[model samples]
Target: MSMWIRIDDGVATLALTPPADRAVFRTALIEARGAMLSWDVASGQRFPDAEIHSPLEASAWLAEIYGEEIAAAVRAAAATSLPVPGSAELVDAAHRLAWLMWASDWWPAGVYTPALNGPILAAETAVAAHAVEHLLDDEDAVERTLHQAVDAPSALAAVPLRLRADAAALLDVLTGLADDHGIALSAATVSTSSADWALAAGARGQIREGIEIGHGLAPVRWADVPAQTVAADSDARWSLRHIDGVPHLHVSVAAVPVAAVPSTEAPGTEAPGAEAELWARFGPESLDIDIPLQGDSVGFTGNMQVAASIALLPLEERTLWIRDPLLAAVPGPAESEDDRDAVRAQASIRLDDPDASLAERAAAE
Candidate 1:
């Protein structure tokens, strides 16, 4: 495959002709971008721009980063004017493998997106590493390099039993790739067998079951509320409940679908009295709570639980005013018993008493 490089406005771009080579080149470029270059801020330039211009120069640079085997392949391809001797599937799989590696570092764990369990992450990384190795015939080179960085398993193990179906599906993909490439995946088979036996023997215990908060809460319009403090499609709810012989008031506001509301203020300008109004609204005894944009929605829940006296207010006084009553994401035709249970479960958690019964927490705020 032919490699082309272009530079404009201090940005560098590399392009490879033909789709298959382009995929492989993109993957390698992702690998190189992080480690291969250093910036000279004083000179406003990057060092060693020379090795990136032609295929021969690129191969020499690749040798320093990815070792001689990959570099030799690139050199051979450039000389013969032919694409690399790897299938499109291998390139695609390798790209995905690289992404999973990056996800291990940069995934934003939150309420909707739960933190990656350590063993599960390790097992997934191990599977992806093995698949890349088989696809590239690299003899565990990728796996070994990854192990040096993180505690990536040499062989997949400790996969939770609940995730066996998912693991099997991943292995099935690897198996198909192996079949297409005419390679035997003995390591993967052995690893799978061991994991299955361990699961059957209860060697690795089950993943901890936690109550999924906000399970049935629907997105409501911001304009529905009198204050309009939250963004559109925000999940907002308030309730008063008795918990463990004590009353509690629970209020929650979650920016659903999107984590944060975009700022409406113009550049280099602050809205007049906005900061003062925000402070007043979020101050003590106020019904509104400041839900930080960066944090999970659960951060805004149960803010008024300490001011339980609000629960003693008359139903008319405590009523949540809605400007447009029907402006909500409608649930199914009828709420099922399970839906009711989920709502009760969520309400109990928000009321700051996990053991409270549904009947005790019936009233809405």
Candidate 2:
């Protein structure tokens, strides 16, 4: 199956024959945006896609946006097939287009920091595209393109002084994309290097307490727990926290496999799905638990309300146990509030200053 873009009447529509995978869809969108950028750069015309809409004055709007020559090229390309320019310049422009789209959704704008100028960014992308168009085969093309684009008087120079750093960061990303085009095409692989990738991959989740306890509780070794049932690096942990002056017991299992609690079916009987079995035993409504297992590595996070009773027991008698469906307990030391707070603070600071060094942003909860 192949994906194509069509401009019928006055509206542009992306049509995929049958249906394509997410990677194909993503590549199609990027190529479409690159085609728009390439046309604008070649014709020296500025027309954002958002401004054009179907109306009674369709001809005027279309002329304002696509002009005549470029409009004809778009119609020709749509009738045939979208041009897939695998050159570094076009790839770099496509990456910039992707980032600009993402920034429209998630760019952080504070009192001091302003929102990204889309037109300006688009213009800079065009300039950078031209600067690197012929340098695709150069050994140091990425760096050279970065320098040429930054030094030239274009949209990059027009960006506000306060937002220049942010703009420069975008330039860095574009250069990196120019250097390695493969990373730009892969949508499934989450790269920690760029916030755009992480955001696109859904890696950024809700903020949670990160507790690291070193002392005060001993590790509880379990001989009955089978090795095959647990995932590699599996660990059962517990934390005691005073939330709003009430003690709460937070329990978690890291890297636990779906088979942690095997089915109790007869030797040859068919069993339910792993998810169905897991929900039957530890469903959120039944146990007030959180099972955020979307991949092979199963995990659990739940709080016990009877934490005060457990905390009142002697240090050695404070052992936790579970049976029937699954036989398990806290296999590691109890976490401390201070440690959790420290981790949470670091996370908060990191959210604010993503560019900050890990060591420098370590002091937070």
Candidate 3:
């Protein structure tokens, strides 16, 4: 129940009531790190939960109470092997702590860039691994087991159901990050909450060639799939590239997509197809819009201003398609202008169809 940091002599020691719950205990460790880093050592002052002690006493107490993992960190600090911070270092570390806390909330909601998400999740996994290793007391053995679990996630299936579930969720999130950014992934998982919400947010999974999302697995390509596409306007630029043999259109937004004008497809008239099923899942508030991006008027041979315009709808109303160039293009935050255009251009679904080959069109052009 109590968590605090004590600095005896020149050695800093972290103490906390280790929660039996793995998730809670892991968070407690993170909090402890932040607390220890912020403790003021000057003026013989200590924080509400902070303590100061001699090097020998602190190590012995930590080793007895928290086990070897934390004790190792403490001993390392005592030996000056660990990077001990001065006042300036404490300030910088505090800033990092604040950013991570804020990021922890936003990343789960798909509010970060592909470039940033992978590193954040990777660091989190490492921290969790350290905590697990300490609690298990096996050091190298336990750490190896965790890495093994990454390759064989089901290896944790034999663990307690709750522990297994947590492990799975962790692996799923990490895998999602790796898959999205075209990074090599071995054994890892992502949170089930994010996966479930992704599906509910109009995303789909291509299981056979993809990573786990929840009870099911989705293709890594889903990370590139945007809820909808938008073309900025007349000045919008476009580019093309191929990933894993799939060519994608990259667009610069000259004019952004507009909101849907309400669907003409009335309820109970006819059965909705796949796209309709996608919208129906969001209830009745969703609207459907299908607008085309015609060629630019400025120069006859200028790049086309292609926009799908579905992203302008509510997130639930919007449907994500695997074939959309946007789905294969890495996503930026909802507010990123230039990056958003690039993402929209990558989402170009027009040339995605095999029936309408790009080479044939190029020949005609």
Candidate 4:
């Protein structure tokens, strides 16, 4: 059979000699958006395989063909619900996506954020309501339905996801830009290969807040529940969550230069449950260093898209330490859960003794 793998860029390049198994490559590029996979046709596998991941690393659907069927399968898998507001927009966007499948020569892969260049547009947001109602799984069938049914699809398959003329407000407070509109904040479903991995890399989700972004120092108050005491370190910074599940506040404090971090937690078998999970007093301490995202860090504080670029993803891919050496290496390539454990260990050490040198803690580990 012919081989294929899509680069981050949308072009579907083919390969003759294939070494990377669909599962491994699928796992590696788990979060790639605009991914759909067709096996020249879909055949029955003994057990159903499902891999969930972020838009960036989501698995490419295995399809019989790459066009609308792949798209349809995705819509089927999406099965739950799109983070849309009105019914009309949902219909429109669905159809829009369906047509994209046919025109793209059936990429068989699914539609990713980048492939969905623009936001779901207004006119088409409601396009999918009825037609997709019955055809449920054939992306191509669905697209043909849309084209045969609605407005003419632009010739280019790469148009951004049509932005709903009605831009939903991610938050009520996000009214400064555009008109007086604020769509309800919807959580983007963040997926990971490992459920445990997700919980561990959760800080990443805290960054996405489940939606597109708004701007400026969005005030994030991290007060421990029941206790009702917010962490005292409050300043303009890039925060990545809202009032949700387990509350966590990630703050980038200035890096403090120090030597010899005092050994606070003696590495010994502690009586299980004897030790408290948290020593709030040892939250974290470091010299103030403005955490930079994008570029300007000073006046930047406000709502941001949950998937807003980490700016560190590329580097993190190589080594988790590059972004925050204190951080355990991220779990992508050339790393393991051990990396995360290592980070936790280093952080624990650092937090125990705030005055310790970052260098010392890193080396000691």
The number of the candidate with the highest TM-score is 1
lDDT (Cα, tens digit) per residue for candidate 3, span 270-336:
1111121110011122332222222221111112122333223354433322223423333223333
User: What TM-score would every model get versus the actual structure?
Assistant: 0.28, 0.24, 0.20, 0.18
Cα deviation at 140, candidate 3, in Å, is 12
Which ten contiguous residues of candidate 2 have the minimum total lDDT? Answer: 191-200
lDDT of 4 by residue, 59-133 (tens): 232232223333333444433211211222222333333333321221111111001111122112223323233
Q: Considering only N, C-alpha and C atoms within 3 Å, which residue pairs clash in candidate 1?
A: none
In terms of lDDT, which candidate is strongest?
1
Which 10 consecutive positions of candidate 1 have the poorest summed lDDT?
Answer: 198-207
Q: Residue 285 in candidate 3 has what lDDT?
A: 23
Tens digits of per-residue lDDT for model 1, 1-365: 33333444433333343222211111211233222222111121111111233444344235443334444544444322222323333444444444444334332222232223332343345556665453332455444433332321212222334444544565455455445545444442122222222110111211123322211233332223222123232344554455554544444443212111123311111111122111101222255533222213222333233354554455444433222223332211322344323333433342343322111111110
lDDT of 2 at 148: 30
Model 2, residue 159: displacement in angstroms?
23
Which of the two candidates, 1 or 3, achieves a greater TM-score against the reference?
Answer: 1
Q: Across residues 16-105, which tens digit of lDDT does each residue of candidate 2 receive?
A: 332223211112122232222221121111222221123222332233333344344454444433422223223344444433333322
Quantify all predictions' global Cα lDDT against the true fold.
0.32, 0.31, 0.28, 0.23
Quick one: RMSD of model 4?
A: 23.7
